[model samples]
Target: MASDTASLRPMPAPERALARKRRYRRRLRSRIILSFVIFGFVLTALIASTAVYLRNRVEDQVISAALTKNNNVFAEGFYRNPDAIGVPFEKIQGRQFSTSKLDRVPDAWRALANGVHELTEQDPVTGNERVYRLAVRKDPDYWFFLAYDIAEERESQERLNRALIGSVGIFTLLSALIGWWSAARVMSPVSELARRLQASGDSTQPEPLAPHFPEDEVGQLASALDDYAARLTEVVQRDREFNADVSHELRTPLAVVKGAVELLLSRPDLDEKTRARLLRIQRAEQQCTDLISALLLLSRNERGHGATDVQRVAEQLLDAHRTQLGGKPLALRLEGSRELVVDAPESAVNVALGNLIGNAVKYTTQGEVIVRLLDGAVEVIDSGPGLSAEDAARLFERGYRGTHAEHSLGGGIGLSIVRRLCALYGWRVRVVPGEERGVVATLTFSAGNGTL
Candidate 1:
């Protein structure tokens, strides 16, 4: 019946919540940084593309205009001289004219049609690469070719391209750094809010959070939290007052009933039937008191720990069930380790274990309901009809009645309460089919500072 060591060590709720928040924050920061980087890269790519297109357009227009001007000047000069063809400008270092055969033109220029064309060739004297623009004209008997050197223009384009690439890299890095700083600035308020909330976990009165921030998204969130906290505090205050009033009003009557039962039990002349009924009444009163205390603790969302013996609580529950058996031929017994103890209030133990035992006794007609205590768990095995698939599936669901419980008297909330208590205390509770016949329910306690 005992739970495994791994099951005994569950993470605390606050720590788990904090870890989840941290993961969310990391994802948020990463998304912000990624968005900024992608935006910067895309914008830089667009601007660089536009700049390259314009630079290429301007370079082509300038080269074309220069080629046309030089071609006109050469034509006029050739028509005037006919024998000597001179360079038009100082930048026009190379000049070539092919009058009779097309073979006199460069091999790269022979395949071109008409308009100006750009080509790269090696200088014969300097052995350096030079770019040139060629303009061709055909007369009746000769072909005129004019070449313009554009090496400096090509060098300028290369430098512009290099500068654009370097700017893109530098701007991208700056954008990433700005994104990081912006994310930090944006998340700082949220981080402070979380810290304040965590620090207020143990406090009865929470500090105002809205006053700490400006009227922005974070401020609205802080204001909302403050409103929720105030409303929750009021609700808790009302719940505490109601629980206190009920305890005061109900416990007094229960104490009087207990005293009256004791007084009646002392009467020697009372009949056996009346005395038995009085004892049942006294037990009922005690059970009610325990239930009230347990319910109050649950409402307060608090755990009350004491040196509680598992066997002792089980025996008491069994005795209570035995009194209500009313001549049913059923055996209620306790088995296994008698020394198993846990650090929980007796009422909490009673509310948890009593529900299992009570359900077992209620459903079973005339067989044994055994309470088995192991290292860190208690099992309630009953020789009732085994649970059906449907019953087992939704057994612990609130307001769900088993097939056998269709005719029973209950709202089907006992197991739900037990489940809530287990979650509150980091315990585990489950139901399974018994070995031969019937069902077994186990309540396993965590091996924390309270387990023995």
Candidate 2:
């Protein structure tokens, strides 16, 4: 059950990239500024850490050397007098112990080598730990221990660390400001290039972008864009000319066929079957004319304005399909509102709505094809094989065919053209599965596009 539900869900490949991209995605300028800030922060931190390490090393070496020298002097003076009143230095405390009384030394200080050792001991009275640099000297007759106070040095180290931290923050802020300024300077030409390119796109002829920029990367990009635009403009102009020529050339034959059909339909002595065949030919010619007009509009990417009767177009489309049904036990229908009208050319309406109706008539084998008219929309519902998720998703894509379209005679661009027409006219169209069976294709006009 879970697998079935998962299979039915939307899991497009781009979802993962989109999810991760949102977290780390940044504008180009923002990324540049961030890079500068990170570089400044890391450099300052490394320098501050090195300064602290070197200061501590030098201070330790000096303290160790002084302690060793002073301890020797203290031992020498104590031995000469056999007793000393106080110590040689102000912050130095010396302790003398006989070799026989080794156990008298405190346990924390007993295992000392003949060098400097730093120890922290808590004072019993204040319950505060005091750091000391202890220098030890062992002799055959006596053992001497000298301790030096280093609390001031520790305090100075702390003060230095605080100052370094402040300096790092200051430098980072300065780097951020510099990065912002540099980014603005660097992006200015690109921004102007983009602005000019956009302006050129909206115009019939574009101005040369490379002329406005220096001979640099931006200029190179602008030159490339100009070349591409020129080629594209030529292609577009050739395409428009071809469509115009085709439309102009085809109208002559279609006009001849239309005149002949009208002349034949006027004959009163024609038999019923022959008249029906002539009417079918007339319908086919009309469909061809409407298709050409729609294609021309599509090529030009323009909308033609007129008040088209929805019911009349739907009835005409259904009648044409009914004749083409042949021996199939199928029915074509139009239901609901009869007063619906659209503010669009009849040929445009005929093409868009006709595609929907034609697809229904094609896929539906025996059941009915119903055209339902709403207030501002038309729905072509068919009692054929229902739509699939994949088909519904890609129904409007150019050159895409549904699963049931294997034996169908089409290039799979009818719905794509319909979609383009809707876009050009500010309308909407969609295909969805019907409630029970078959498919329902709806063509909805915008509020400004029609009247009930």
Candidate 3:
């Protein structure tokens, strides 16, 4: 609650500057804390010294203004001199003070001579009980002994101490307020920088806000951030333009491929051999169309700005492939959860999966092709001659061919299409030996889930 109130308060320039200082200089927090500690120590020393000085000075003034007479009141038969009782002031050894010449000089005489005394129950000189203010009145030639007791000096000292202590309290409070205000001022700019950096993550590139202290470390940081943001923007812009170019170019070829495939399939051939050969050509043409579509999907995925109906697309591709591979003594096992969602265009998933399945049907002379979808992974297992260890290592690379399937059609771009599409979506691809005497290639969309 207090923090909100402070934030809402119209921030002064000093407070904002201080906040910036603190943000960039996390060390500044510790420094300010240490400064306050040192300040407290110094203030304590100053206040305590002031209190002591006031106490001693007031005591001196009170003692010097008092009147002293004879010591005449002792129930134990101590005779009163000019004072109530003649008591001598105890002089410290090796200290230059009054010497006793005039006998039984009073407290008033000591006060006038700028001398100090203590009134104690015990006599300082002889340990006998007495109330004493024994001092000397020093003339240019001689010193006179004085003895008397006064209570006003001790009381005055107490009052002075009280006044000094109050002043110290007020001073400490003011200092803390000023310190807190200064700290808040320095932290403001630092917080702004933090916010901008956080927002930068979402954007392709975000320029840093202008810093108040551009000449200092904070300024250097802001300048560096702006440079980084500009670089990032350039990279993103370049990638976007590249994707756009690829998409536009691939669409025309893909349309021609589809038209050719449909034209061939619709033809009424003359003989069985010619029909079979035409079917082969039609199938090849369809593969070319699929490749072009996959390329377009890769382009779209690279741009990474769309709401893709991945599940619907994947199912549609599976239906088409199921029709294409009809009467081939092979079964396809597709597995997915009800919500098999993804992060790229529907074309991306279809192109990627179609390449894998098409390759499977091409190589697999017999047995089952399993399209397993667990989590976000799509694995195609075919009962073809499995990829050699050497080939599997570089299977997804463009134009790469395996030892067993060296004569495979479509220029070995099936897996490469898969790879490029996965790149667009930032998916992981793994090609390993299938459980049986076959091969398995997997496109894992673990990262692409949230990419949309």
Tell me the alpha-carbon RMSD of every candidate.
Answer: 4.2, 4.8, 14.0
> Which model, 1 or 2, shows the larger lDDT?
2
Q: Model 3 residue 451 lDDT?
A: 36
Runs off by more than 4 Å, candidate 2: 1-25, 76-87, 100-108, 111-113, 123-129, 448-452
lDDT of 3 by residue, 45-158 (tens): 686887697767775665444422221112112222323333333321111122453444444344454354555676569876654454443544344444444445456567
lDDT for residue 342 in candidate 3, whole number 0-100 = 71
Ranking 2 against 3 by TM-score, winner? 2
Question: Which model is ahead, 1 or 3, in terms of TM-score?
Answer: 1
Error of 3 at 439 (Å): 5.2
Candidate 2 steric clashes: 0
Candidate achieving the largest TM-score: 2
Give the Cα lDDT of each candidate. Answer: 0.82, 0.86, 0.60
Relative to the true structure, candidate 2 reaches a TM of 0.89
lDDT of 3: 0.60
In candidate 1, list every pair of residues with a backbone clash: none
